[model samples]
Target: MARIPTAELSRYLLSGQINRQGCLRLRRTPFLPRRPPCHNIRPLSTTTPPTSPAVVVVPLRKQLKDQAKALKSSGSSPRKKKKNSDNQTVPGWELTVGIEIHAQLNTSRKLFSPALVPESSLEEKPNTHVSPFDLAIPGSQPLFQPDTLIPAVRAALALNCEIEPVSYFDRKHYFHWDQPAGYQITQFYHPFARHGKIVLYSRDGIAAEDGDRIEVGIQQVQMEQDTAKTLAQPGGVNWLDFNRVGVPLIEIITRPEIHHPATAAALVRKVQMLLGAVDACTSGLEAGGLRADVNVSVRRPGEDKKLGQRTEIKNLSSFKAVEDAIIAERDRQIAVLEAGGTVAGETRGWSLGGTETRRLRGKEGEVDYRYMPDPDLGAVVIGKDLVEFLGRSMGVLPDEEVEGLMGRYGLTAKDAMALMLLDEGGRVEYFYEVLGELEGRLGGEGKGEGSYALLAANWCLHELGKLTEGEDAEPRTGLVTEFVAAGDLAAILYHLHRRKITAKTAKALLWGVFNCEVAPGGVTDAIERGGLWFQELSEEEYAMLADKVVEGEEGVLAEFLRFKQGKSKGYPQGKLMFLVGKMMKMGPEQNLDPASVKRVLGERIEGVYLPQLEGEEK
Candidate 1:
């Protein structure tokens, strides 16, 4: 018989516990590798084996203390403190964050079964959208759905991922009430797409012209089946909602590259935009259409190569929660490490109003889940032609759209981002449609594109956005688009640009049309019906009105004259505007332009009032 080497025995002894009599015995754990049969080997130690089968367990806090002492005694020095983006500093720690986003694919059918994917709304009934295959009944076979592939591919391409020609699925075995099949079908060994990047700007532009941006590396985007939702009822009874079971989901994993809390939130927001742009997912965090799992860790400043223990915060439903959870976890880890303790790797849950993350369970390793390729479902073979077709149909991604808005329309980065970030492409489309109409009507003959583009962006983001801002219960954007046609808005802007209507009159017209208070006719009809057109006044008329107003308001005229002569402590321009407002109120039906009124008032002050005052003083 072969004998076990002393070195091997020593290595095995290191992993086990030493009894009172000095007998070394190994404890079997799911994560550890299997050892050789004990009957085949002779005992090397003189001490007898422990009589009891129970293994000695050490407290986790004590283990952490011992590890911290060991590291301290090893002569390792702490690194210098660093400042984060918010200018906050932890004395000797650095934060690292990574996000796992699971977005429900926007397909009619589930991922594996032929059952319909539920709407997942509050009014949806439970267990109505399930199939025999989803429940894992006997004689039911798992079949892959081809409808989910296109959206997944489009999303991967939008994130700049490289799609694999052939990818296989694996079964991650676990026992949970929500998992009806006792295992989740996922792409474990080989995902469909990998190696992508999402660039988050510090401000609004894709290029990050201010030299501040984060390039988060995408590890992989894999398709998987979502588990059912388990709702806890009274008296410890749990209700299962199988409506969401077997729903198609694409899990996007990112490399641990994020550091700041805001950056983490920005990455989530950017991912939502990308997925929504491709129409691959609903990307609505509130409706459970999208969920995020955040992995956060903290290390010393110079330990970039060596990461510390990370904890996973699961199912953060909102961007604010994502940022706050990261910050809270980071501070918790720093506190543990600074107190001469070690941080544990575990899964945590965050409440909406809670300040700290609560422990859910210990983190599971790959070995614990016992991952293996699915024998029933064969490999997914994607053709190059299909990939190319999906890529062609991707239309335009969010970053590309932002660049187009900036370059083509000469919009500021802030304005462009405002339009794009409102609600995917709706506001941007409205802006573009209005701008296109304006360009067609007023592109030539000394009409500047920049001015019209700015006008359109302002109206879309400010005016139209205000109408649909808080109306989240309804499809407010669709309602506004249906009611206010793009051509009508463009015509209103064109008339305003041509100096034929006052700015106030244009705004009132927009509000009236949006509220259905005005007729649904064109801008010309609305203006003509309301008699809101600009009433041009000749120089003689303006000068006579200016003289009449100046003569009527003696006190204001005295203040204006004194200010012009540097003898008063009041704003002469404001007094002039007050008089111009009085003049405007005199002709209520004229719809006089404020700019023209201000311009003529300034001319009267400069050419008439000041000269007259100088003559009187002389």
Candidate 2:
């Protein structure tokens, strides 16, 4: 628990500034940490910034050069190369990261108005969804909407946040074109929830041991209204789409527990999945439904007394950007400190194209935005009824889902996380649907450790995943629904499990079924129509195939003989096994048990080559 200096804290707490040439304003900052200074001094600018405070904006060219140098130093090339172990930080320093994520709740109407909220305001004409309140009409008064509270509480529960019994709203003053009211409504003084934790796993897919696991603490979860977007039209025109104005948002704040770039990225990803699971928000980062602001600081390896000055990177669009920004910034700061220059406490912006960040503004020089409790909206009281309803209706959390899948289906941690990490919920739904159908077909469940469950898991993640990947990854639609029904997929896997069809035939059947027209007699019928039926070879047939392979390749026989004499460089038994595999696959439609084929091949090889060895010894 390092203490941040109060003078430095002032820079982060207050954000208001006036330009010498003109009046410039920005968005509202909801809350700031309050830590008293060890020694008090006269304040510089508590309410407004003084004129011409020398704001040092990093030059674009310098930033670009830094990005290039960083990339080259990190060994990035035009062609993708295997990630080097050097990417991890050196042992002398530690990285600290905290995240603030804003997710728009999935609601039809605005947070405080009857205005309909569209997924994208760009899709509709300008201002079509705007209500009087959205436009800041003089007579319209604010109305508190309660529907947004349920989802917020649900999200808090999913994240293990402690819900506040009473929550209230406040107005943060900032003048912006998108904020027609000259202020934003948010829960700052009294947020909806606080003090939660998110668990993190290591790369090995095993939950880290209790002492080793990284558990990021949730500082607070607050409800707020989204501002409108200032859109640029064709032909030098710009307009405001108020459709997004006043839309509900849940701001999740995390404690500075993340120490690695990869872990920070994983934290964001896990939160997104959890949000989607609880139906709080869609977690579509590209579509603007969710975004994160990262706070990063660095300190000496063993120093726990003071955290270095942190810079905030705002509005990262994707998890990749989050990871990249943290790494780049961390390296940049360390380089600056090593060169005897100080790291600036300021806001920065990340360019997705360049994979770097640029200075937005100096934190110390910014002006403060005044905040006060809103007069119109009363405090919201969460009763037992609503809490009970939320507790019951809130579905499986992301972590719980992973554990359940692993326990019930006997899946590996990696496999479980693969399905859980899918951005599209349909993929997860389809996986379980197929899993359930397969389980039922396999005669109820004892433990999913059986061959059928393992095969189904592979097909679901690899083959079915491939089919559902790309722009059309939506579940239960198009190819997912049209071609492969759950029952059909389950039947195919079931037949493969029962050894009624070889793995090769089953794969062929799956692809053929996907590309084929509607089958008149279902998947089994389609398998028959496509001539994918497995043809099992008898014992005699197996022996004949093995004999043909052994007799046809004199070189292979020579290698086997050399191995028997202990003269071969490598194991001849391995070569023999390889030959057996090739011999089995020679006939495409032939389905012989691999064990049976191996046994027959061993007999043929021994009968033919052992006598030669015996003769040579004599």
Best by lDDT: 1
**Model 1 agreement with the true structure over 238-267: per-residue lDDT tens digits:** 555677779999999999987677778778
- lDDT (10s digit) by residue, model 2, range 1-618: 345444433333222122323222233356755434322222122222344242244544566678767777888834542242245463678888899999999877789998887766434555567677876765578887788887888889888888889989988888776787899999988998999998876632212222346778999999999987754434443344566789999999999878777777878887888888888895566557889999988888676578899999999877767877888788888888888998989999989535457999866321355788999899989887888789888877777777777786788888878876654455567777877887787775324444566677788778865555647444444435356777778888877876777777776666655666535237677767767667788888887777677665767777777776788767677777887678867743367777677788777777866676567668
* Per-model TM-score on C-alpha atoms: 0.77, 0.78
Full-model lDDT, candidate 2:
0.73
lDDT of every predicted structure (CA atoms) = 0.77, 0.73
Query: How good is model 1 by TM-score?
Result: 0.77
